[model samples]
Target: MNKPECSRLYKVATKHVCALLLCFCLSLSGLYRVSAQDIELKNPSLETKVLSSMLPDGWKRFEQSPDVQPGACGITQSPYAGNTYIGMMASPDWSERIVQELVTPLQANKTYTVSFKLAYPPEYFSSSVCSGSFAIYGANELTEKGEILWKSPAIMHQDWKPYTAVFSTTKAYKYFITGPYMDTICHNAYRAVLLDDFSPYMREVPQIIVQARNSCKGEQTGSATVRVKAGQPPYRYRWEPGNFSDSIVKNLEKGTYKVTVTGANGAAATTFVAIGENELTADVTSSAPICHGDTNGIIKLNISGGVSPYAFSIDGGVSYQDEPLFEHLKAGNYDIEVKDGFNCILNVNNFTITEPEPMEITAANASAVSCSSVKNGSVELLVTGGVSPYIYEISGQSRGYDNVVSGLDAGDYIYRVYDQHNCYVEGETVINKEWRDCAVFMPNAFSPNGDGMNDIFRAKVHDAVTEFRMAVYGRWGQLIFESRNPNVGWDGTERGSGLPAGSYLWVVTYTDSKLQEIQQKGTLVLVR
Candidate 1:
């Protein structure tokens, strides 16, 4: 072997290396071309419609059942981004779904980001229960079930909101489907959602460089430098508090600074830097324990002269949170500590959560009866201890505050009382069969003044009266008032004139549940 032979071998190897390099560059070019291709979607806005049957141009149905098929219905609100949007009914039975094919199959083992706008239309039908959630799925083709890529939290507003999800697949995907989760049933009329502007694109992860200079001794400001390493150039800089457009920002205060660099192609990178901070302090305000509930109380912290992105710990440096408020704490003392972005820590100790006075409540049912005639009975509650004006709620009956619950059929009932602080107490009562006799009682005297109590001369009926009649007369027996209903009462007035305070005669007749008929005569005194 000689030097000339060695030179020839080196040249051959160099040629092969150069050829491989060219192929690699060509492959990179092809990747960019593929990404430039739009995700061919038919009727992306779901604008195609036929009568009450709204069928988007390119979407497929989950089922062939005419009664359960997906279609467009007129919506009062305008679409979020286009003229038409797709909707689905979520129910206990098979949920209605809208499906469509993707123009290009998703590459196997590749990651893609998907985004769409969804809304819960405010208009509702009979039996519509407010349900605002649905799921997105991916599969090779349309089928009864596919891979669940995303299930969103319930959407509750009529205004449209954007939702996004990212997924990586081992197999190529050719279809996109939307519907309720497999286990969720849609018996409520509110179980519907509007979807528009669906999109899928390959997401690019970015690589960037960021450097910062700390302030020297006696210096009050620092500087930061950012440079792009692998992304497209002509980058835009968004520096916190400064909003500077250049890559270099100087004269920043002694704290923390963050900058986001976005490339012309929509790729972005974020970096954070801290300057100087000697010490940080945290102050806290503790809330006392609630009166009678499982969630105990709350504590909030106020941080002054510290770096951004604060972390808090209820215990002594055991755990931390980004939020400054701590809730659902038991009645006891606590030690709170907070740390800033610069690792500077501040601790607040000896905080106590006091317990509020207990609430007392009692419930009773008047004229108790069996389930067949329980409406005749009334439930009365007496509550003490707790802030006022208190609001009351029954487990299945009352929605507002009431001392008496009437016209209820026989059933076991539970009630809750809420005060100004939203603290609550719960109690239970029941109505059962125990028919009681109904009787009429006449008051000996009455006052017609505007005071809330004893303001009318009326006969009181107890237990359950079927029929009642009452008559009032002057001293000479001149009929001054008459009423057929038992609850109707008379004020101290004749023909719209205020009568002088005096004694009057009253006669009453009533039919009780236990008696056929009865009559009673009594003398009444009226006073201002």
Candidate 2:
């Protein structure tokens, strides 16, 4: 309760506080000393000396404290008398040594900054003391084996203040040395130079953090979020399944997806998220087949009942995210497989494709014509057999000439017919009689003179000619006349036109009255 007691208690508390403070300072000092030792210095000293002379062995001196100009009062006396000072003196000419000590062992592709403190004594030079310079060396010989990393012309004043000159190490040097290369042209003789707090050049590597997700929702309401540490802001974020935007993924499908993040500083990071499933069924469809050659028709398959965005594949091929429609398919069996929103694939049953058949050519009789003679004969052919709307080929030839022919011809020939399916049948009969001259044969020849004689070339035997084609060529092998009807023919003229004075070859071939190719060839002389 007395003043003396209160004062004694306060003193005791002060003593304890002082002891704790002392202990804290000692601990901090020990840590600082350890950290300083790790900074390998070439010239570790706390004395004022020319940086060139302080350099270790193999180092050449560049410059020292050489006198510049004389003056009564200089910057050496007042504000600049602290730990930092600047002076104008010739460099130790040891530019080589400086470089060797500071730039010989730096790594490639690394970024680093150089830093050091400088001060100028106002008493050493006139108030006009303007600037100073320094150099670095990596080799003792200082040949072209090193480079200049930094230079400065710091404005000098009458203050002992700290200044820093920064530089970066190049890939050519693995180690380096640094010191002052002075050019002090002062008007005072008391100029002083001091340097301290020189930081060892070092590079800082950038840090990256990448994140990813496994799956996401598959419907309109489904979504996934991805985050990454890509350095600075204004980062570019992009999603694989959609356009690039500043968005956490939304309404995703059941499948794998990727997200890329790029920062403004050219740094990049990536993340992934997968959407959930929502569907189960798939729909398949195909165009109607027209013929065996209609293989390029579109075949489409749409999936549903499982997920929104589904994966698709055909016959175990590479999987694609978009709905697929195949083209250029042949007439055969096919299988299409589709994956649901849950990454589940369902293989469809085998489906067959059939194309329509072409027209067919058949014969009503098996009869042959004699050689080198005109015969008054009738032939029959059936074209309405096999697949409906069929195309046929009819051919016939003599016994010796096994090359079956089509159309009507004056010769002994056998007949053969083919249907739309490329299937054929043969029929034959022997003729023992010879014909006379210029015989007007039925369904064999027609004179298209336009005088009501034979205006049309046609096969008019009796039975229906299913598939037939008649063509007439000029003497120059050019098709001058053609007729598909059995009642049409070429007369003495070229397609009812006046004939020139020349010999033209005429050929008639078909399955005449018989279901075989009857080929006939003859020369018709035209008189003007």
Candidate 1, position 353, lDDT: 77
Task: State every prediction's TM-score relative to the real structure.
Answer: 0.35, 0.32
Which 10-residue window in model 1 sums to the lowest lDDT?
64-73
Error of 1 at 23 (Å): 36
Q: For residues 1-528, could you state the per-residue lDDT of candidate 2 as single tens digits?
A: 422343244345545544554455445443322121122333222223222112222222333222211221233332222232222332223221232233224444333344455555433323332344445554334344445566656436433345543343345464464544445453232223444445432322222333322232234545666554213445677778786475466555556667766555433455565554544566677764444455655568866665456666666646564666766676667777776554555677676554544334444543433323424333454654334433323343232212233334444445555443544445554333334332223333445445775455443343324345556666898776666665565554554566555666556555643455666556554443
Among these predictions, the greatest lDDT belongs to: 1
Q: What is the lDDT of residue 199 in candidate 1?
A: 58
lDDT of 1: 0.65
Query: What residue runs in model 1 are displaced by over 4 Å at the alpha carbon?
Result: 1-40, 49-54, 62-83, 105-116, 122-127, 144-151, 159-174, 180-190, 199-235, 245-258, 261-528
**Highest-scoring model, TM-score:** 1
